[model samples]
Each structure stands twice: as C-alpha cells, then as structure tokens.
Target chain A: MSLELRGLSRRFDNAQALRDIALQVDGGEFVALLGPSGSGKTTLLRILAGLDFPDQGEVRIDGQDMAQVPARHRRIGFVFQHYALFRHMTVFENVAFGLRVRPRASRPPEAEIAARVRRLLERMQIAELERRLPEQISGGQRQRVALARALAIEPRLLLLDEPFGALDAEVRKGLRHWLRALHVELGLTSLFVTHDQDEAMELADRVAVMQAGRIVQFDTPARILDQPANGFVAGFIGQAQRFAGRLTSQELIFEGLPLAPLPRALLLGEAAAGAGQGPAEAFVRTHEWQATPGPGNAVLRSARAAGGRVQAVFAVGPALIEAEIPPGLLEPGETCQLDPLTARVFLADTPFATG
Target chain B: MTPRPAIAEPRWARIVLCVLALVLLGLFLVLPLAAVFTEALRRGWGPVWQALSDPDAIAAIELTLLVAAIAVPVNTIGGVAGAWCIAKFDFPGRALLLALIELPFSVSPVISGLVWVLLFGAHGWFGPWLQAHDLQIVFALPGLVLATLFVTFPFVARTLIPLMQEQGRSAEEAAATLGASGWQTFFRVTLPEIRWALLSGVLLCNARAMGEFGAVSVVSGHVRGETNTMPLHIEILYNEYQFVGAFAVAALLALLALVTLAAKALLERGGPRGSLAA
Candidate 1:
C-alpha cells in the first residue's frame, strides 16, 4: 500500500528527534532512509508504524489518516535492529505469534496456524530451525525469523531498522541481496533504515538522505550521487575531498593549491554558475577525479598497485582522501595535478550550502 | 592444544577465595540451620511431635500461610505493573515512582508495621472512622497481612524493574507491530521473558511474608492463636520457655529458606534463553 507523511515533528524534552518530515512512498517500492545515527530515521519509521506518535503531523496509509489507529491495529510490520525475537519461543512459535494473538473471533484455527507457520518457515528457508529458540539460531537466521514473524500478520508496509547492521560484512551483503530479492518476490513495500551509504545505494530504489532530523534529499540513488542536495550529501555518500575556493563571474580559483582558474560555466549547472561569490566549496568524488605526476592541486601521500590497478591516497591539506590513480604516474610525497572531470560548485551563500 | 588464558586468577588467590566463601557459608548459613533442627529434637521425638501438634502452633502456621497467600499474589501483580510502568514507558514522575516503590527497603520493618498502626489504630488517622463503621484492622489478621505486604512490597518490583529494563521495550514493540494487543504482548511476550525472575520474586515475597517478625510484632498485639504469625509464635514460645516449640518453628522457617534457594538456583541454571533473559 502507498504511504504518505506530512509535517511530522517529534520532540523529546529539550532535543528534537524529528523535524517537519514529509515523504510519499509508492506501493511495492523499496525505499531506504539513509542517515547517520541520531538523524531520526528510525524515529520516523516508528511513527509510521504507530509504535510512536508524532508531536504534530499526519501519517496516511492508502489515504487513511492514522492518528486514531493504535500500533496493533495499523498492521504495519516493524523488524527491530537487534532482532527482537521472543527468547522463550521457538522459531515457528515466533512466526506464529502474530496470528495467534489475534482476537478470538478473527483468530485462525490451530491446524491452520500451524500450516501457515510451517509455510512461512519454509519460505524463509529456516524450516529446519523451527524447533530452535531465537538464541539457538545464528544472527542471520534470527533476522529471518523476525522478518517471517512480521510478515505473518500480512502487513501492508514492512519497516526494518538496520536489519543487517549487527551481522558481519560478508553476511550483511548476502542478506541485503537476498532481502531485496524477497521483497520483489513477495511484492512487499519496504522502508529500511541504514547508515551505510553503500548499502542504501546498492539496495534501494530511492534513498531519502537524512541529516540532523530532516530529510535533506529524496531521490534515486544515481541522482543523489550525481546531484547531491548540498555539500554534506556529496561528501557523505562518496569517497571525496572537500576544498574551499574563491569564485568570480569568470574564473574558479583554489585557496591553497596552485591550480589555474577554469571557466565558470564548466561546472554542472548554469543556474548559478556565473558566480561572484567568495569562499565556495566543492566535493569531487574519487571516481570523478584524475591524477597525474605534476604539480597542480594535491600531494600524493602513497600509491600502490593491487590487482593490476594503481590506487592512491592524496592529501588535500589536513584531510587524506583516496582515489584510483592512473597506473605508474605518481610516487609517494610527489605533488600531482588532480583534475575533477565534472565538478558541481555552489556559491558561498545565496542558498543553503555547506563545506 | 589451545593456549591457556593470561587473565585467569592465580591458583593461590583462587583457592583462598573459594575456601573463604565456603567457610563463611557454612558458618553463617549451615550452622544456624543445623542448630534449629538439632535444638528442636533435643527433648526427643515426643516433645518435637507435641510441639508440632500444638493448637497455637497450628494456628500460627495457618495465619502465616494465609497472609502469604494474600500478600504474595497481590504483591506480584502490583510489582509487575509497577515494573512495567517504570521499564516500558516514559512519563512524568517515573524516576520518582521507582524511588517510592523502594521506600519499604529504606524504612525499618518496625516502621513499616507502625505506619499501618498509625493509620488503622484506635486513636490513629482513620481509626475513629473505622471504629464507627464497626471495623477492626490494626490488631487483627488484616493488620498482620498489611504489615507483611508492606515489608515485602519491593521484592517482585525490585527484582523485575532492572531485568525488564535490561530486556527493553523492543520485544513488546515488535509484538505490537505484529498486531498483538497490549495484554497479548504482555502475557505472551513480556511475562514469559521474565518468568524466572518473577518466580524468584514471588518465592522471596512468600518467604518474607511468612517469616516477618519486626513489622508483624508491632501490629499483631500478640493475640496468641489469632493474629500471631510464625515468627511471632516462635518468639512467644521462646519467651514462655517452650524451647522445643520455638526451635521447631525456626526449623520450618529455615527449611522454607533452603527450598527457596534451591528453586531459585534450579530456575537460573535452566532459565529462558538469550543474554537479554531474566
């Protein structure tokens, strides 16, 4: 089902947890709420699930206002970050909990519940673990149980809070891919929260980038990568170095590096290209930049050849950033010409901008 | 072979600590318990059986059991509710409620009983109103039950709050999102999760309610076969020089304590699974 949120804000005593958040999710869509910790993405998910309430705003599922609905009545599934499985119950019982807890009039028969639970266990590929308690299963298997439990109620929207955050790196990759396939297989609309940018970019159809309790940008992963809303998104999403420079109507000049000013129109957009703004900053993703052995902008700290390709670490002033350098071009401690093929520069202060 | 850990305690220190702990347990626990049983049987099996069959002793046992039956379940329900409020939800005065639930622990047991007297005694706060209504409480079974309930009020709640807090509200939240109502989530999820700790709390509450002396004495009025609990009955028998009877009652209390300990340990070893378990 489609979900829409408008003007959602929640405050806990002195600190604001969420701020005027608004988003619309189409049915059967895979969305990612990508943000660092304490950015309020999880809080947003909780509010939508009716586990928490917004201090002021509206949440609608299929155009029904959700203010009066309780969490249990909302039928919005939530899988916790730590896999909140019932420790006392076996995997099958955990999956059966939702169905069994329904009111007597609507509750299914025991045989039906068992059949349904067994089917779900088989679908989760954890049929053998049905008799084992949550503690007996591996972390990955426990998450699968949690997911099956949430799905038992046939919820319209599934919300996962860092579902793979606790697993090892290799396991997290396999699970996310498997989860994505399951989402499509079941035609389930899911919104998962994660701080891992690569996970969001790799798994989500559209990512809502959040920072400091607000959604800064909501777009496709490629658009968010190519045209970030501000400097934070650009720096946060990709491997890059941040550098400040002066911008005149005709030329762009660096503050510390000895690089020549290029024409102003060369940057991404011409909307605010001819700038007369001072102290503008830009982030060039490592893949967007090329480096050669010559004195230009940045100093190469180290270069090593691995798997027949040279990868280098460059120092742009105090910060060290990595990029794939052309093979055999630069040595350690040598200055290089770091050229950004297509840079997006925003002026110092006409709009909301950052370093 | 796997290498030995570097952080293991030295052999001498470990041995000394273990010996010391065993010695302390024997001295403080085993000796006193053995003394009660030995003293009860000193006058032979006849006096011990006679003491056990005494009408006053039987009355005391009945009264103590009744008080525990009333107090333990009430306290368990109250404690679980209080712990649920303190652990699962945030509200105004939450910390204050937690501190207040522990008030019995800080207050002396005599004071806990005396407060009831101050409220229900003939000349105390609600005393006149109760008297006019032809109701008796301060020096009766109700008084004994109240005093025991007062002293043991914190057992279940104190045991549960920290465990519940450590277990967290996530499980309940998960159950709720799965379409479980409040009671369903609690009975199905929270209660089972905390069952071992809950059982221990009830066992402790029952023990204290049956064995309570200081508070029950203040409110009991020493009404022999009527209001006297097990501890009060033992005191009266000891003061009256009925050594065998007093020792017999003490042995029973000690047995109860041992049973509680055994049950507690058994529950822990075979407790519910997970690190977030009770």
Candidate 2:
C-alpha cells in the first residue's frame, strides 16, 4: 500500500504530541521513522495503523481516505514493542487468532487456517515452538511469534513499533538483517518506528528523521548524513565538531586566527547574501578533521586505539575537538595543525558548542 | 570459615511469636469451627438429618442457591464491563465513576438493603408506579437479589481494575490492527488476561451472596418457606431455642465459606495459568 499523511496534528491536554506532520511512502517500500524518545514517532505510526486518530489530518492508503475506516477494517498488521503475545495461548493458537476471528462468511476452514499458520511459522523460523506457550520461549522467539501472528491476517501494510527495542544487542543485530531480508522477499509496504539511528539507516530504504513532532528531514541515509538540512539533523545523525567563526570574502576567522577560506557555494545562500559579514558556525565530521604533525596552536591531549582507529582529542584554546586518525600517527602532548577536509557552514545566533 | 548465624531474630522471640499466632488462630478460627460441628452432632446424626430435611430448611437452602445463581452472574458481567470501561479508556468523571462503583463496598449491608427499600418499598420513591404496574419488590425475591447485588457489587470490578490497568491497551490494539473486531479482541485478549482475577472475584461474591444475613434479613419478611434464606433460617431456629438445628444450618454455610477459601487459595497459587484452559 502507498500511504500518505497531510496536516496531521494531535494534542494531549496542553502538550502538543504531534504538529502539522506530513509524510509519504510508496508501495513495497521499507521506510523507518527515527527519533529520540517523546519525538512522536510512535504516535505517527499509531495513526497510520488506525490505532489512533489525528485531531486534524487526512490519512490516505492507496488513494482511499482512512478517516472513516476502523482499525479492524484498515487491514494493517502491527507488531508491538513487547511482543504482546497472549500468555494463555500456545504459539500456534496465537498465530491462528487473526484467521479464526474473521467473519464466518469470509473465514477459511480450520484445515486451511492451520496450514497458513504453519506456513507463516515456518517462514518466521518458529515452527518448532508451535506448541509452546509464550512464557516458555525466549524474547527473540516471542518476537518471531508476534510477527507470524500479525502476518496471518495478510494485511495491506505492516507497522512495527520498536520491533527490536527490547532485545539484547546481539539478538537485535541478527533480527535487523532478517527483517530486511523478509521485507524484500515479501515485497510488503512496511514502516517501522525506531529510536536507533543505526537500525533505521541499516534496514530502511528511506528514513524520516523526527524531532519533537515533525519530520525534520526525509531521504536516504547517505543523503541525510552527507547533506543534512538543518543543525539539528547534522548533530543528531552523526558526530560533528561545531566551531564559531566569522565569514569574510577572503577567509574564515576563528578567535581572530585565519583557519581556512570560506567555500564559494556557501556565500550564495539568502542568509549569506543578506549578511556578507556576520557570525557563522561550521560543522565538520570527526573523521574529516586531520591532526598533522607540526608547530601549531593546537595540542594533542590524548590518543587511544579504538575500533581499528586512533581516537584523539585536541585542545585549541578553549575549544576541545575530537578526531579519528590513523593509529600511531600522533603522540600525546604533541603540537599539531588541525585541517578541515570537509565542513558545512551555517549562520549561528550564539557563540559555539561542540558535541 | 565458621558458618554464619541462621536466625534473623532471637530464637526466643520467634518461638513466642509462633505460639502467639497459634493461640490466636485456635481461639478465633479453629475453636468456632469445631464448636459448630460438635454442637450440630451433639444431638446425634438423626436430629442433624431431620433438621436438614425439614421443609423450611430445604426451602431456605433452595432460595439461597437461587439468589446466588442470579446475583453472581449479574455482578460478574457488570464487574467486567465496569473494569473494562474504567481501565481501558479515559474520559471526564472517570475517577467519580470508579468511586461510585466502590461506594457499595464501604456502606453497611443493612444500609444497602434500606436504600433498596427506600427506592422500591410501598411508600418509597418507585413504590406507587411499581404498585400501579402490579409488582412486589420488597419482602420478595427481587428485593433480596437487589440487596445482595449491592453488597457484593465491588468484588469483581475491584479485583480486575488494577490488573487490567497494569496489562494496558497494547494487546488490544495489536488485536485490532490484526483485523479482529472489538468483541473479538475483548474475548480473546482482554478476558484471558483477567480470567483468574475474575474467577476469584466471582467466587467471593457467590460465597457472600449465599451467606448474607443483614441485607437479606432486612429485605426478607421472615415468611416461612418463602423469603427465608439459610442465614435467616438459622437465626429463627436459634431464637426458637433449637440450638442443634441452628448449628446444623450454620455448619453448612461454614462449609461453603471453607470451600470458597480453598478455591481462592488454589486459584491464587496457580495464578494466571490457572484459567488457561477456560
């Protein structure tokens, strides 16, 4: 199903849970909603699944307005964060519930229902757990049972709310790969809500980064990383070192010291054109900053070999910057010159902050 | 290394507390139960059998069971609906609604019966219209059922609310998104999660309904073989100085209470898995 949302807004008492949210997902596409806690990503997913209704909005699934459709009639499959498997039921019975609850006129026979549940169990690799109660299985196995149960209904669209949020790191990595493969094999239109940026970037074809209640940026992982639209996206999506500087026609001045020349493309924007000389901020990824051995203003405070790279901290006056460098390239307490291989410059209202 | 001390408290204090508890149990619970059985059988098995077979006693037992049969199921349904409404949805005056449901629990049973009488008695609020419609509520089965319902109203709902609230709405939402209707979700997901609590509540309600004395006595006109429940019958027999007969019927009610306690203990021990078969 192709899903679209327009002007979605929801309020809980005095708090605005969602505000003027808009999004679109093409058929058979795997999209992910990524954000921190309380960012309204889960609320948006609930509205899409018809579990919640927006105060003012229109949700269209394949050209059909879902405003009047109840959740049962919407034919959307939802997997909960905690699995939510029925504790009293065996795995097979839990998966068969969707088919058995259908109206009698359209419901399949018992034999056919059993066959379909068995097939889904086999596909989810939980066939051996059919007779075991949910409490008798591991968390990962319970998750698979939940997925099989949701798939039994043959829904038009699938929604998952933090599907791997409760699992251990090792189990979560495996499930991410399995879920991506399943989405490809089934060719289902799936949208999953997650707070882990790595999981979203690894599994989704397109990622919608949400903050507060609105989608700040929606694009591929590479685009969102390489060309972030705002400061929030640039800081949130990856590690970046920010520095306050003054931009002029010749060079960018940091603390009255000329660091580098201003890029010509940055000077073409409306803000740059309106104020040719003003305070500006520059964001450079940790790996993009180089610490070359030389007599310079900056001193390398520390260097440690980690994750196949040397992570070194440098002190340049009051600001401390982190950079990833090749191992054994720089010693502790050595003076070096810092060079920015690539950076994004923006107009800042305040001084400077690094994270 | 030497072994650590095994006791948390001094040995004398533990012994004293244990003996004190045993003495209290014997004085309060065990003694009374033994007295009832002993007194009932003191006059020999013949009188015990005769008291049980008396037409009035038989009628009282039948009436008590009938009232339980009617009141228990009505309260169970109402309780489940009340819990579902209170726990699953948010609305204005929700706290007030819960307070109202718990109101009957805090009121005296006699006051509960009196309230019904004030509303449905001949000289009360709905009396004239009910009389015009040719209905008899007070001193009748309907009045008895109403009073019992009031006294036991909070059991099932009170048992279920905290449990249902803790379980939350995620499971129901999952069921709905999987194409199950509202009714299907309730029966398959919501009810199973609360089945054990519901059963425990119903058992308590049934036990109280069968043995209720204050409410039933006020509503039942003491009409022989007609309005008399088991407890009322026991009172009459005792007042008439038939000690053995009174103790015989009291023994039966005691057995019912014991059975209820046993059932509750079993259900609590098995916990959520107890109602899996249902």
Candidate 3:
C-alpha cells in the first residue's frame, strides 16, 4: 500500500501534538519517522493506523480516503513500543488471534490457521516458544512474537512504534538488522517511528525528521547527513557543534572571528533574505571540523578516547566545540586551529536554530 | 558469600509489633469466631443441625443464595461495563460517573434501603402509581434485589478500574489494528487481562450480597418464611432468645465469609501475569 498523509493536525488542550504534517511512503518502501520525544512522530503513526484520528486532514492509502474507515477495517498491522502481546495467551495463540477473530464468512479453516501460525513461528525463529506464554519468553522473543502476530493477517501496511525500544542494546542491534531484512523479504510497505537516528538511518529507505509537530525534513539518510535542510536537522541527525554566529559580507563569523567564506548564492537566497542579515547559527558535525596544531587557535580543553576514536573538546571563546581527532594529535591545554569542512548555516530568526 | 543486610527495624521493635498484631487478632477475630462455635455446639450437634434444618432457616439460606446468584451476576456485568467506560474512554463527566458508581459504598446501607422505600413505599413518590398498577417493589423480592444490587455495585468496578487503567489502551489498540472488532478486542484482549480481578470482585460482591442485613432487613418487612435473608433470619432467632439456633446460623455465615476470604486471597496471588516479567 502507498500511504499518504495530507494536512494532518491534532491538538491536545493547549498543546499541538501534530500540526499540518504531510508525508508519503511508496508501496513496499520502508520509511522512518525520526524525532526526539514528544515530536509528534508517534501521533502521526497512530493516525495512519486509525488508532488515532487527526483533528484535521486526510489519510489516504492507495488513493482511498481513510477518514471513515475504522482501525479494524484498515488492515494496518501495528507493533507497539512495549510489544503488547496478550499476557495470557501462548505464542501460537497470540499469533493466531487475528486469523481466529476474522468474521466466520471470511475466516480460514482451523487447520489452515494452525499451519500458518506454525510457519510464522518457524520463520520468526521462535518455534520452540510456541507453547510458552508471553511472560515466559525473553523480551527479544516477545518482540518477534508480536511481529509474527501482526503479520498473521497479512496486512497491507506495517506500522511499528519503536518496535525495539524496550530491549537491551545488544538485542536492539540484532533486531534492527533483522527487521531491515524482513522488510525486504516481505515487500510490505512499512513505516516505523523511532527517536534513534542511527536506527532510522540504518534501516529506512528514507527518514522524515519531525520536530514539535511538523515534518522538518524528509530525505535519504545520506542526504539528510551531507545536506541537512537547516541547523536542527544537522544537529539532530548527528553529533554537531553549534556556533552562534552571523553572515557578514560573504564571510561566516564565529564569535567575532571570520571562520570561512559563506557561499554567495546561499546568502543571497530566500532563506537569508527573510532574516535581513542580522545574525545566523552554524552547525558543524564532529568530523566536519578539522583541528591541527597552530598559533592563535582555539585551546583544547579536554581529550578522551571514545568508541575507538579520539574526541577533543576545544574552548573557542566562551563556547565549547567538540571535534573528532586522530589519536595522539591533540592534548589537553594545547592550541589548535579549527576549520569548518562543512556547515549548515541558518538565520537566528529561523525555527531551525538549535538553541 | 555476601553478608546479609540487617533488618530495617530493631529486633525488639519487630517483636513488639508482632505481639501487638497477634493480640489484636486474638481479641477481635479469634475470640468472636471461637465464641460462635462454642455456643452453637453447647446443646450438641443434634440441636445445631435441627436449627439449620428448620423450615424458616432453610428458606433464609435458600433466599440468601438466590439473592447472591442474581445480584452477583447482574453487578458483575454492570461493573465490567462501567469499568470499561471509565478506564478505556475519556469523556466529559467521567469523574462524576465514577463517583456515582461508588455512591452506594459510601452511603449507609439503611439509607440505601430507605431511598428505595421512599421511591416505592405506600406514601412515597412512586407509591401511588405502583399501587394503582398493583405492582409491589418495596417489601418484596424486587426491593430486596434492588437493595442488594445498590450496596454491592461498587465492588467489581472498584476492583477493576485501577487495574485496567494501569494496563492502558495499547493492547486494545494493537488488537484493533490487527482487524479485531470492539467486541472481539474486549473478549480476547481486555477480558483475559482482567479475568482474575473480575473474579475477585464477583466473590466480594457475592459475600456482601448474601451477608447484607441492614438494607435487606429494612426492605424485607420481616416476613419470616418468604422475605427474610440469612442475616435477617439470624437476627430474628437471636432476638427471640434462640441462642443456639442464631449461633448455628452465624457459624454458617462466618464459614461463607472465610470461603470468600480464601477465594480472594487465591485470586490475588494468582492474578494476571505481570506484563513486564520477561
């Protein structure tokens, strides 16, 4: 199913949970709604599943308006964050729920239901746990059973709200790869919500970065990393050091120091034209800034080895900027020149300001 | 091996608290229970059995069981519906509705029966109309059922609301997305999740319905063989100076109470599986 959401908005008392959001996922494509907590990603996913209705707008699946369709009629398989498996049911019974609950006219035979459940359990590698209650299995196994249960009905679209959110780090990592492979194998249109950027980037064909109540940017992971639409996307998708600076006469100034030449076309573009050239913010990822020993440069305040790499924190005026450096390149209290290899500069008045 | 941690309280303090609890239990619970059995069997098992097998006493026992059978199931269904509304849906006046459901528990049982009498008695609001229609509500079976129903109304709902609220709506929503209807979701997901709590509530309701004295007494008109419940019957026998008979019947009620207590404990210990066990 090709999912499309247009002009979606929801409000809870004084807070706007979702606002004028729009997104699209092609058939058999995997998309991730990526955001921090309370960013309206979960709300958007719920609206798609018909579990929640948007205050205003339309959800269309393959050109059919879903406003009048109830959740049961949507045929959208949803996996909750905590893997809401029935506590009393065994793994096989939980997986067979959707099939068994079907209206008798369309329901499959008993033998067929059993065969399908067995096949799914085997495919999910949880055949041994078929007779075990959900509480008797590991969290990871429960997650698989949840997925198998959702898949039992052969839904047209799969919606997962943090499918691996409750598992341990090691288990989450394994499931991420497994889910990616499963999406490919099943060829089902899927949309998953997650706050983890790494998981989104690794698993999704495209990532829709949400903030507050809107979709801020929607693009491939590579594009989202290399060419973040604004400062928020740049800082949110990766470890970025933000500099409160401004664009002055074709030069980017950081703390009254001219750091690099700003692209002339970008400065003259519509984004900067609205701000009227007062002040701007720049976001530079850890690897985007190059640091080398030099005179009259930012002083290195600290150095620590992290994840098989060296991370050095530099004190540039009152601001602290972190950069990834090679081992043994910089020591604490040493001076180093900082150069921006890449940066995303947005006007201070823009909503994309990280601060 | 690691050394065990010290107890939170001092040893002397723990012993004092334990002794105090045991003393209270003995003075109030054990003494009363022992007195009932000792006094009932004072005339031996022959009189005790004869008192229980008396026609009026037998009628009271049958009437108590019948009332419980009717009242418990009715309240169980009502309570489940009320809990489903209060727990699953958010609407205007939800708090007010919950307060209404619990109104009977807070009101005096005498007041509960009096309210029914006021509605259906001779000079009360609905009395003239009821008399004109030749329908008897007060001082009848309907009045007794109503009083019992009102008093036990909150038990099942009160037991379920907190539990269902804690479980939340995620599982039901997941079931809906998987193509289960509202009824199917309730039966397959919601019911199983709350089965033990529901059973516990039903047991409590049944116990209260069977043991109810104040409300049933007010509404029963003391009609010995026809309207009197077990508790009312025990009171009549005691007031008539039939000590052995009253104590025998009291022993039966006490046994029922114990059975209710045991069932409640069992249900609580073996309640729904913990959602986060794994």
lDDT of 1 by residue, A296-354 (tens): 67898988886766778888666576778768777888988776665566555645422
Residue B111's lDDT within candidate 3 is 95
TM of chain B, each: 0.95, 0.93, 0.95
Per-residue lDDT of candidate 2, residues A1-355 (tens digit)? 7888888998888778888887888999999999899989998888888888889988989888895577888989999999888888899999999898899999999999999999999999989999999999999999999999988998899999999999999999999999999999998999999988889999999999988888888899988887666666677778887777776765555645435555645432233444356677667788987777988867899888899998889887677889998998888889988877666655666322211
Residue B210 of model 3: what lDDT?
91
What is each predicted model's overall lDDT from 0 to 1? 0.86, 0.86, 0.87
Sorted by TM-score (best first), the order is 1, 3, 2
Among these predicted structures, which one has the highest DockQ? 1
Q: What digit string (tens of lDDT, one per residue) describes model 1 on residues B1-278?
A: 99778888888999999999999999998888889999998988888778878999999989888999999999999999999999999999999999999999999999999999999999999999999999999899899888988899999998898889998899998888888888888889999888888988888888788888999999999988898888999999999999998999888777887888788778777875443244
Candidate 3 chain B has its poorest 10 consecutive residues by lDDT at B269-278
What does the lDDT read for residue B166 in candidate 3? 91
Candidate 3 residue-wise lDDT at B199: 85
Q: Ten consecutive residues with minimal summed lDDT in candidate 2 chain B? A: B269-278
Task: For candidate 3, give the lDDT of residue B40.
Answer: 91
Q: How would you encode candidate 3's per-residue C-alpha lDDT over A1-355 as one tens digit per residue?
A: 7888888899988899998888888998999999999999998888888888888998989989895588999888989999989888999999999999999999999999999999999989999999999888999999999999999989999999998789999999999999999999989889999999999999999999998988998899988887677767877988877777777655566666536555534442235445346577777778777887976458999988998778888887666788898888877888878777756677777664221
The parts of candidate 1 lying over 4 Å away from their true place are A269-276, A294-298, A306-308, A315-321, A350-355, B1-10, B273-278
Predictions' DockQ, in order: 0.90, 0.76, 0.86
**Candidate No. with top lDDT:** 3
